[model samples]
Target chain A: MTAETAVPPTAAYAADAVLTEVVGLLVEVVGDEILIATEIDRDSSFNEDLAVESIEFVALAEKLEARYGARVDFMAFLSEMEMDEILTMTVGTLVDYIAAQPAGEPGGEV
Target chain B: MADVQANGLRFHVQHLRGGRASTDRPTVVLLHGLVLDNLSSLYYTLAPPIARAGFDVLLYDQRGHGMSDGAPTGYDVDTAVDDLAAVLKACGVTGPVHLLGNSYGGLIALHAAYLHPESVASLILVEGQCLDPAHSGLRPAAGGYPGGWVEDVANTLNLIAIGLECNPLGGDLGSRGARKAARMRAGADTLLNQTTLIEDISTVRLLTPGELAQVKCPTLALYGGASDLVDSGPMLAGQLPDCTLEIFPGAAHALLRDAPKELLASVLRWLETHSPAAPQFTGSAGGYRLPASGGEGAP
Candidate 1:
């Protein structure tokens, strides 16, 4: 399969710093199988273009929640999107959502 | 049943063979949930009925369960499935076998199917959760019938309580099955957790799309709407492919005992829906014998 071409980042969301860190977590949770380059961005669909599954997203949510002192509601993600949608979700979307949430002690909830 | 002497393993298995066994009907192997009244609980409740439906049913206890010898290596998911594999091999019970796992047994079956998809025909999960060591109902990770004898008993009780709450067969949340489950909880037996199983979750994610796609076989996820094992069973159903989900309106985790007639009907219906041919095995002196050598491919 050809690498999913990354949607260009047009330097629009300068405040989305948390996404850089979230991409690191994604790399760790997802490993480097589908990723071709480290120049990550929000337009990546974690499952679709990238091949991640719903379970790993739970791990990603837990990892982000812990690393950032935020409680990402992983269950909500389970209901809202398929793995394909997640595979291509933009980094801006992820960081914006995390920043919107209240921070807490980082950890997994079961 | 013919037996194969596995290297380093003391147990030898017997494969009950024949064209007489060749009813062309598929077999559903029964794995015990917990708190064994021995393998009889599985065989008596599940095996014959499944056979009557023209599906073959294999029932056995885990190490330390029923007549099976216990090992210091003892109860966990891998060993349980290994024992099952050894049993299937010894009996030449090859080809696709439907696995019906109750409680922890169901979890082991999941591991088995995941690791050795070739051996698994399909899965019939009766309240089995995709457990992570971090998430079973127990409060302590190191519990069950271990450490001192007291912890072991407590662990067993704790283990039963988890299955009771999550089992699809358990009857009305407050019914006799619940009472029996509560009583089982108070008595406790074995404490098998899934730390190793948890470590293996990453492997599950490693399942290639090809493997997942190959799993186009029928899957039935059953839950007695009365049980509390999970807040939701349909949610799990949605995650699986080619799955048929059902809620036994009044049944619970102990469906066989809680609602025997209903359980029988539902099981037979599911078996019929899944099985391609009539389940016929010539009655033998030892048990149901085969009509032919159990084949090496899908039924």
Candidate 2:
């Protein structure tokens, strides 16, 4: 596990900062296999680029929830789209979602 | 993602807290089938809907399958029951739980309930294999239980072993399929056949009529209408007093893969009726709410 996997989300939100943390979590999920840390950029797609399997994606979702708590309503975020959309989502897309959220509204009621 | 140490082995456990996590709701524990299968089967299918219906869901890769540690021995029903007990305790689940087992997992669930009735609140067996001579026609004419499903299971194991040895290495499957199939085959070739999994399971004791009667928890048993295992469903239903048997029309043994929507519909209804804890529904604030019976979240 990387240091980012253990760090709690900060009160502040920056797109780049969220990207860095997301990439780190991806690294932890990908482990030493196929995941090339340097290749994961904002446009990197989970399926096309990382080839993340279903179970691995589930693990990534769990890791994201554990690190960010209620701030990231990962399931709710994916609920609006189809599985294909979720699989094709880019790292930048997730960063934007995280950056767009209000600071203290971690309940994610919206 | 949880790594629980139970039965002297490290198990990959996935516990999904529902909307009512803080409430004293009954947890639903799912058990997957033997080799080449894992918690992913249930995780992708029934778990989310059940969670949405307001119950915490717990799924784990059984020992030697998926991410769980593999042992060479202890594949018998007794060991499986002991493992379930230990895993529940390790996961801090002390209250009575509803067990949903698929394939061989159903056998383990029935045995576990019989052995430790206090731990299990109810059972949902899907295409459960009845290995005893009394259930199937494979028993010896001399009035002794012999080889039956064990041989079939062994055949499947051998096929998996061959697939493991030849297919992936020989470049037959797709890149991702090859990787996952290779991993599954590794366990099949190593622990599944090389160990005593077949012998232990073949000789494992089946529940007698009296013992089945003692497991009085509300039970739901499903089987495919056209499946060869259809007879086992009624046999099990006759044994358990409070059991409800539902056979899906024109479905086969691979009911999970086939007719998932219908299966989920039946499961949701069964849970709503039998779950000891009532569902705690919180308004989704205009979000999606699953109909009392349907397969909206299926993939």
What TM-score does model 2 achieve against the real structure?
0.77
TM-score of 1: 0.49
lDDT tens digits, residues A4-103, model 1?
4564332333236566678778888767643563356666555434445433454565576456534655434432543334545766677777666554
Instruction: Assess the local accuracy of residue B61 in candidate 1 as a C-alpha lDDT between 0 and 100.
Output: 51
Model 2, runs deviating above 4 Å = A1-20, A36-51, A76-110, B131-147, B162-168, B172-177, B277-299
Residue B28 CA displacement from its true place in model 2, Å: 1.0
Shift of residue B292 alpha carbon in model 2, Å: 26
Report every candidate's CA lDDT: 0.53, 0.73
Could you give the CAPRI-style class of model 2? incorrect
lDDT of 1 by residue, B93-136 (tens): 67678887776666667667766776676787776654322322
Evaluate every candidate with DockQ and list the scores. Answer: 0.01, 0.15
lDDT of 2: 0.73
- Estimate TM-scores for all models: 0.49, 0.77
Candidate 1: fnat, from 0 to 1? 0.00
Q: After superposing the true interface residues, what Cα RMSD does each candidate give? A: 21.1, 3.4
Residue-by-residue lDDT tens digits, candidate 2, B148-194: 56566767666666665564454444554455455545657776557
